[model samples]
Each structure stands twice: as structure tokens, then as C-alpha cells.
Target: MPRSRLVFWLFFAPVLLWLLLLIVLPHLDLLTMSFRGENDYGEMGWTLQNYRNFFTEPVYWLTFVRTALYALITTFITFLLAMPVAFYISKLARSRVRGALMILLLLPFWVSELVRVYGWMILLRESGVLNFVMLKLGLIDKPVEMLYNDAAMIMGLVYTSMLFMIVPLVSVMESLDDSLIEAAHDLGAGKIAIWRTIILPHCKPGITSGAIVVFMLALGNYLTPNLMGGKNSLWFTEQIYNQFIASFNWNQGSAFGFLLLALSSLIIWAGLKLTGQRLGEVAS
Candidate 1:
């Protein structure tokens, strides 16, 4: 057999088996559990009641709708902000400067998410640094309550998800030929026209792919929303967590997990369509 085939068998086969044992099998088990109904001692009785609760429960659907809207808005905002940063770093920054800047962009991932979220908690609190600074600067007489709200959750989401959006966009943008933009300029096209007619078309895949990744993550995140979203913002993942760990309702938790999985699939599918993926690309 070929060396490549030998390597695949040696390396990839074990990983494939591990995935089957761990991820795929567990996910399948969850699917089975989702079809069951709640029972005494937190056990499942095979029925469709768990799935029925998702649609019929007003609170469940409300949380779902709210989470979806937040995710969509977060994804769009992250893309809009990250695009210029990625394009600039790829096209304009010097090689050494790019390394430093990229590190700055990715530096937060070095810390735990809990730590980062708590850091935001300190910053956005009434007696926090922002309030003190604004007051000292005579911008405001009193501290604004920036903590414990949807706006705070959005800030946290944007901060955490920015790098995911930036990296993919940069990966595609760095490969772009600068001469094409120059050629457009040479043809007497204005800056806006060149960006709209040329650069936008070339970077569509990166934009779509990055936004999808960010959106899925933001939608499913429990930490940021629960910590920053406060009592007012009812994120759906918190419900899943409560059902599984707090209340020990495994059936309901599984149903919630399946709903999240379905939502993620829909968003990813839409992204693939918008990005114009080929058949082979989708398959592989």
C-alpha cells in the first residue's frame, strides 16, 4: 500500500474510532433521550413529550427567539468590525508588526473564558473603572449601571468572538493579489467602487465562514449570557444547563440540546449557501 494510505490508517483511523466512541455515540444517545418524556427519579420514558414541550412552552420558544436574534446581531456586528481589521492586517501591516498585532488580537484566548467574563464584570460594574474614569473626566456626574444587562452581554460576545471572525478573514485575504486592487485603481475606479466591485466578491467565503462560526458560538454560549445578561436576558442555554444539572431533567436537556444542534445546522447551511460552496467542498 502507498505511504499516504499507510499514514492515514496509522494516524487517522484511531482518531475516527475515538470520535465514534466519544462524540458521535454520545450525540446519538442524546437524540434517543430527546424522544423520551420526563419521569420520576430523573429517568426517561420513551415518548415525544420532551420535543413537544419545546414548541408548546411559550417560555422555551421565547428564549429560543431571543437567543437567535442576539446571535444574528452579534454575528453581523463582529463581521462588520473584524473585516476592516483583518483586511488591514493582511494587506497593510508589515510582517513583524503583523505578528505582534495578531498576538494582540489573540491574546485574550490565553486566559480562561470565566476569567475574561469576570474581568468584564469588574469593568462594567457601577463602581468599576469605566464609571470612575467617566466621572473623573466630567463626562457624567453619576455612574451608569452598565453591568447585568443584554448590552453588557453583547459587549462580552463581541470581545470574545472577534478573533474567530478575524482569523478566517485574514487567512483568505492574505492570499489576495494586491495588484488587482491596483489595477482597479489604475482603471480610474474610486476606492469605494473598487472595494464594492472587487474586494467584496473575493472575500465572500471568509466572511460567510467566519460569521457562521461566531454566530453558532454566540448562540450556544451560556457563560457570557448568563454572567452578563443578568436576570432580564433569558438565554436558552441557561435553560439547558438548569434542566440537565440543576433540575436533573435529562430528557428536557436532551431536547434542548437537539434544538440547539438543529439551529446551528440551519445557520451553517445558510452560510454554506451564501458563500457558494461547491458540492465536493460540502461533501468533504
Candidate 2:
């Protein structure tokens, strides 16, 4: 082989091996496990029983649907909150201020995600800092039970996922031409009209990228929902975890894992179709 070809192979071989060893092979094993089933005597073999259980079990399918909906809600809320912040950092702030804001945004990410979730637990629990502050300010008569609830779970999801949304939005929005906004203003276009016609259209790729990421993360999250929402969370990932660890049913866990993979793929495909974006463009 030529030197260039040999060099190419040298660099690509590790990546190819990593993908096969870490991703493709494990997924193939899981795919097999998902389709297989065990007899009453505990003998495992090929069957569709695992998949069927997901549909037949109200606890399983209902939690799946609830998790999907919550994930969607988290993605939307993250986008709404991140958009303004990204806009300030990328478009409105001075260079020094932008740097400072970016540092602030990045600070939380330096810590482990598990630690961040625990921090939220400390702040949102009934006797936590937030309730103490509220009591001190005389805003409430007593400490509110803020933890182990849907609101707390959602807040944790949004807090953890917001940076994913903000980074992409800032990347796209920063590239937007300031001249276009000035021109629109000169033409007497209203702020909302300018935003609708100019800003959003230009940022569709970023929006799609960010939403896909945040949605997938929220959907697959177990720790935040489990720790913050307690037993009532019932997130599908928690179900998968229980099946694999607590119940020692790898087949069911594998099936649920594949279902989540399918869900993410379907949602992403639908979003790309609705937005008229090609996968290649979004990937780039």
C-alpha cells in the first residue's frame, strides 16, 4: 500500500475498532437479547415475549409515554430559557461580558452531573436552602415540600440540559449577520417580525440540534428523576434500570433500551421532516 493509504488506515483503525468494540457489538448483543425470551423453567431462547410485555404491562408503556412527554416538555422549556441567554451572550453582550457569561454558563458543567443533581436536591428539599430563604423573607408560613415531585424533577432535567441547548443556539445565532437586523429595522419591520422572518429561520439547524440532544438526554435520564422525584418518578429509564438490576431481567431491560433508541430515532426523523432539514446539514 502507498504511504498515504497506510497513514490513513493507521489513524482510522483505532476509531473503527472503538466503534465496533464500544458501540456496534454491544448494540448487536442487546438486539439479540431484546428479541429472546425465557421459559417458565428459566431457559432462554428466541421469542417476542419481551417486546409484548412492554405493551401489555400498563406500568411499562404508561411510564414510557410519560417519560417521552416529560422529555419533550423539558426540551421546550430549555430552548425557551436558553434562547434569550444565548442571544445575550452571542449577540448583545460586549466581548468581556460575553466571556464572563460563558464562564458562568460553563462553571456548573465542570462538576459531575451526579453532584449537580445532588445540589438541586439540597436546594429544593423541604428543609433545604430555598425554603429557608423563603421563610426568612416571610414569603411563606412554612417550608414547602419542593422535593420528590414532578416540578423538582423537571427543574433538575432543565437545569442539567440547558447548556446543551444554549451552546448550539449561541453557535448559530452568533453567525447571524447583524446587518440583516439593521436592514430589517431600517425597513421599519417590527421586532417580532424581524425575529420571526430573520432570526428563527437562520437558526433552525441549531434549534434542531439542541432540541434533539436535550430531548434524548431528558428521556434517558434516571438519576435526576429517581433522586428528585423519588418512587413516583416512574421514568422509563428507571424502569429499564429496575429490570436489569433489581429484577435481574436482562431481556426486558434490553427490550426497553431498544425501545428508547427507536423512540429517539423516530422523534429526530420526524423533527427533520417537519423542519425540512436534511440529516447531512444538521450533522454538519
Candidate 3:
């Protein structure tokens, strides 16, 4: 064998093995499990009941739709919040300030996601820090219930997903030429026009990539929605968890998992199509 071919295999083999073992195999197992169910004789056989249940059951389908909608909303909100920060860090900030700001963005992630969600709980709970401060400042008559709601869940999702959006945006935006914006401004283009004509067009790939990632994370998230939204979360992942753990129905869980995977893939495809970007372009 050639030396280059040997080196290629040496590098590629581990990645190929990792994907096969960790991703491809597990998904295949789940796919098989999703099709297994009891027949009239009470023997497990190939069946579509698991997938059918998702559509026939109102709770199941409704939760799935709700989760997708929330994920989309979370992605859009994260994009809006990340864009300005990415612009500042990439285009405007000095080296020292940029580094400091990046560190701040990354600092939360150094802690486990569970810890960060609990931190939000500490701030948002009725007897937590925010209410105490508000009471002290005479801002409210009593401690307001802030935790365990849709708004709280959305906030937690956005908080966790922000860094994902910002990193991609900043990465792509850094490559944008400042001279383009300068030339546009020099030609009497407004700030909005500069952003519309230059910055946004330049950042389409990053935006699409970030949005896809954020949507997937938010859609599949269990901890933040479960903890922050409490009993009222109603997230599809919670349903999947219930099916697997709480109900001890692995087949149902597998079906739900595949449904989620399908939904993520479909949305990502649609987003790329809408933005006139390909998966390869976004990934690059």
C-alpha cells in the first residue's frame, strides 16, 4: 500500500468507526425497534403501530407540533440576540475587548447545563433572587411566579442556545470585508441598507447553520424544558423520555425519536432551501 493511502486510513478509520458505532448503529437499532410490536398471537413482529400511534393520539401529535414551534421561536430569538453581539465582537471590538467578551460568552458553558438551568431557577423562582430584589426595590407587591412556564422555558432555551448561534455568526462575519460596508456608507447607504445589502447576505450560511443547530438543540432538549417548565413543559422530548423510562415502552420511544429526527431533517432542509444555501455551503 502507498504511504499516503495508509495515512489516510489511519486518520479516517477512527472517525468511520466512531460514526458507525455511536451514530449509525444506534439509529438502526431504534429504527428496527420502532417497527416491532405484538401481533394477534401476542408475538412481537414487524408493525407500523408505533408510528401510527403518534398521528392518532392527540397528545402525542400536539406535543410534537408544540415542540417544533417552540424550537423555531427559540432559534429566531437566539439569532436576533446573537447578531448584534456577533457583529460587535467580530467587527467593532478591539482585540482585548473581543477576547473578554468571548470569554464571558463561553464562561457559562464551563459549568454543566444542569447547573446553568438551576442558576436560572434560582433567579426566576418565586422566592429566588429576582423577586427579592424586586420586592426590595418596591417594584411589585409580591413575589411573582416566574418559573415553570412557557416563557421561562423559552428563556432557558435561548440562554443555552445563544452561544451556538453567536459562534457561527461571529466566525462567518469576521471574514466579511469592512471595505464593503465602508463603500456602501460612503455612497450614502443607510445603516439598515448596509446590513440588508452586505452584512446579511454575507452571513446567510452562518445564519442558516446556526439556526439549524439551535433548532435541533432546542427541539431535543430535555433538561431545560423539564426543569424550567416543570409539570407544564409538555415538550416532545419529555414524552419520549416518558415512553422510554416512565412507561417502559422502548418501541414507542424509538418511534418518537425517529419522528424527531425526521422533523429536524425536514426543517433544516426547508431552511437551507429558503435561504438559497446548500448544506455543504453552510457546513463550510
Which structure among the candidates has the greatest TM-score? 2
Identify the candidate with maximal lDDT: 3
lDDT (10s digit) by residue, model 2, range 139-178? 9998898999998899999999899899889999999999
Error of 2 at 102 (Å): 1.2
Arrange candidates by lDDT, descending.
Answer: 3, 2, 1
lDDT of each: 0.88, 0.92, 0.93
All candidates: CA RMSD (Å): 2.8, 1.7, 1.9
Better by lDDT, candidate 3 or 1: 3
Q: Candidates' TM-scores?
A: 0.91, 0.94, 0.94
Local distance difference test, candidate 2: 0.92
C-alpha root-mean-square deviation, candidate 2: 1.7
TM-score of 3: 0.94
